[model samples]
Target: MDPEILKFKILVLGDSGTGKTSIVRRIIRDEFSLVHSATVGVDFSVKVLNIAQGLEIRLQLWDLAGQDRFNHLSRLYYKQASGVLLVCDETKPDSLDSIVKWKGELDARLQYKIPAVLLVNKTDLIDDEDEGFSEDDLEKICSRLRIGSWSRTSAKDGFGVNECIKALVWDILSDKESKTPDPLTKTKDVFDWDDDCSSSIIRLGRQDLDLANSRGRARKCCH
Candidate 1:
């Protein structure tokens, strides 16, 4: 069976120092790095995720710089974007508040709102509720911003990373199913398992002939 493969350009956005790069590094490499240097303009990477027995998706992660200076460069990468990941630092309230702007800019550029997930990163805090926005606030933000749902994630410890992204991928799949076929989706080239049956039969026949010859040689030696 030829599995279907869907490729999507997912945009990741947040204010500067909101752990956007950290989340990207964690998802892309499965390893956390302390260095959170500001992305120059845009950082691109691809991740192939298996969905079912054969279905898969290629997520093209476009990590947009959080700096206001790069705001002009944001539109350049907005084309063909199928999903979005709006991240916020759980330890920084301002960073979380800036998600609204990111959401607004994304909605403004895209013809239609694609699937989006809001992520609260750095949730290893002892008292996250007190230190940052509360769960109630996050829900309200998600509802107001038109995001489907929100999740708590710790990129440093790799908590809730894959689950959140998988949720978004599923949403993208559902969205595409309800409408026109996604241009990015295509059937994967499947191997022809039965095409070599004749070759296998020939090899087995040769093996059996060799075995008979060895048996004949043993009989001659015994005689």
Candidate 2:
């Protein structure tokens, strides 16, 4: 059976030092970097990801530079973006606000909202005494931004990295099924960040990816 092909432009936005590039490397290249070289302006990567049985997603992952100086350049990449991943650093709480601003900027530029998810990276440096983003904290933001889901990740260890991408892609697919709301539209406001949080992986069907590119077509929003 031929699986349906879908191509999507997914923007990865976050403040510098939040490990956006590292996460991108882990996903697109299956590698991680120890050096913290910042993304110059905008970096692009692509992967054919498996979302479900008989369904594959050609993800054009755009890793936008987090430097404030590149704000204008970053907004240019938001045009016709299918979804967004707002990466934030666990240690640097201020980055969370930046993620909010980035989301707002994306909507303002695109003239509409698309599915957005949060990836709180740097989980490998866990501090037990530190208070992380609580349910109330997430609820308020999720309600306002309409973020579909969020999860803790460690780009260094490759933990929950793939799950984060899968979650957002799944949300994009749901938005296309009908104008009516579905489970994907519902706020999955929270995900367990504990050691057992591996369960967060999207369980659309069989896992992993292998499909034809052919400029995949299912719900690509951009021309």
Candidate 3:
């Protein structure tokens, strides 16, 4: 049997020019671009991250467009997200304030709280230590959002890139661990699968089988 690999979908959300894409690139590619075009709809990338012990998580990172025109498309990507990184440009204080809108949208779509980390990006843009948002502001955000931690990251110089991602992954893992039940206790929602959802086992099985048959016929024709 193939080795089991845990997969988690993580969403990157922020306003335009907040460096959400740059942060993802820094984490997955370890490269930075001086000028990156604004994301249109959404971009996808995968990275294998080693967390605690020998466990590894395959992160499917989705970089959502920050433009208001594409706000309608956000739900399509966030529906399957396991965690979220709410990024903001440290230099542009306004960007930090806009995190409220991003967080609201995510909450409206998700209907339940998901593990999220607040990231202040572009720390390099600040020439002095006193230029960026104050600790009081960050504390207020954390308190209002009930966020456990926040980090300042610089996508250009690769500062705190790994740390931010690792923190998010840790939160995801911790959330999963808390949700798991002990051997003696029964699961809380065992009938979750019967929640009257359209994406049931029968539907998914038939869809997969149909696709496989279609591919098999194509292969036979090629032979």
Q: Would you give me the overall lDDT of model 2?
A: 0.69
lDDT of 1 by residue, 1-223 (tens): 8766778999998987878888888888888887667899999998776543355567899999888998888778888899998898877888877898889889899888888888888877635335666666776787788887667778889766665676676567667766865543432221112333432111111122111132111000100
Off by over 4 Å in 1: 181-223
lDDT of 3 by residue, 1-223 (tens): 3423678999998999989999988878888999878898999999874322223458899999888898788769888789988899988888988888888888889977788777778877877767888766876786687665677778899776666565566566667767767521212221123324332111111122111122111000100
Name every residue pair that clashes in candidate 3: none
Candidate 2, residues 124-164, lDDT tens digits: the string is 78666345555456556666777776677789988777767
Model 1 lDDT-worst window of ten = 214-223
lDDT, candidate 3, equals 0.69
Clashing pairs in 2: none
Higher-lDDT candidate of 2 and 3? 3
Q: TM-scores, in order shown? A: 0.77, 0.75, 0.78
Write down the TM-score for model 1.
0.77
Q: Each model's C-alpha lDDT?
A: 0.70, 0.69, 0.69
Which candidate number has the best lDDT?
1
Which candidate, 1 or 2, has the higher lDDT?
1
